[model samples]
Target: MEFVRLLLLFLHLLGMGMLVAMFFVQRRAGADAPLNKGWLHAAALQLLTGVALVGLAPLTDQEYDHAKIGVKLLVLVVIAGLVAMNVSKPKPATWLTPTLAALVVVNTGIAVFWT
Candidate 1:
């Protein structure tokens, strides 16, 4: 169970990294790059792994803090929603990646710095 938790954590971070990477790629492409499948996949993985991590925390003998988890979950939902909304667009809104990236960073900060 501990190993499973670790794996989920890894996947969660992988998804976060993927989001940041896509943000950079989109910025570099300068509106030429549409939201790719990678974005959706990453968002899904991030969401799934995050929930699973919370569910599995008890198995690892960790206490679940509902407040922190709830905040992070809310941010992730926004990130996922943004990705889903833009995935099918021929040209996503100019603020999409910037907003998503900022939210991602905010979530990460919450995860790392929240008590």
Candidate 2:
């Protein structure tokens, strides 16, 4: 169980790192490029690992603040929604990358500090 938890945590952190990396990657793609599909993939990874961690808490003899988890989930949902909506466009909005990056940072802050 501990190993499972650690694995999930590792994947979650990787998802966060992917999001951070995507920010820079998107920037370097130029103003006319489509939003990368990597954004959706990373958001999905974060979402799945996050929910699995929460779902396995009892089995792992762990506990979490429900309100904090809820808030983080909400933020992640927003990030995923933004990505899903824009992933197919010819060119993303100028504000989209920054907004997504800010949301990602906000979500990470919540996870780290909301204990």
Candidate 3:
């Protein structure tokens, strides 16, 4: 189970990196591509794996668990909203990519250090 959890964590981070890279590439190119499809897919995969990790991990009475879960969910929702906004506007916002990437990093930190 620990090995599986570690693997899932690795996959989750890889997916997040892909998504962040896609956003940066889009920013540089000034145009979107079918690659955005891959970004969305990766983001979804990360979210799934992250949730699975939380579910499979042993229970703890620490308040940090609930806080971490809440923050992760909030960040996920923000990222999804950013994606939706970009889709609707036909262009990614100036701050969207950086903001989402920062959120991901912060969430990762919380998972690694707060727990």
- Best model per TM-score: 2
Candidate 1 TM-score, C-alpha based: 0.92
The lDDT of each candidate is 0.86, 0.95, 0.70
**Full-model lDDT, candidate 2:** 0.95
How does model 3 fare in lDDT?
Answer: 0.70
For residue 112, give model 3's deviation from the true position in Å: 3.6
lDDT of 2 at 20: 97
- Give me the displacement of residue 30 in model 2, in angstroms: 1.1
Q: What lDDT score is found at residue 102 in candidate 3?
A: 82
Worst 10 residues of 2 by lDDT: 106-115
Q: Is candidate 1 or candidate 3 better by TM-score?
A: 1
Per-candidate TM equals 0.92, 0.98, 0.73
**Residue-level lDDT tens digits of model 2 in 1-115:** 9999999999999999999999999999988889999999999999999999999999889899999999999999999999999999999999999999999999989988887
If ranked by lDDT, best first, what sequence of candidates would result?
Answer: 2, 1, 3
C-alpha root-mean-square deviation, each candidate: 1.2, 0.6, 3.5
Alpha carbon deviation, residue 36, candidate 3 (Å): 2.3
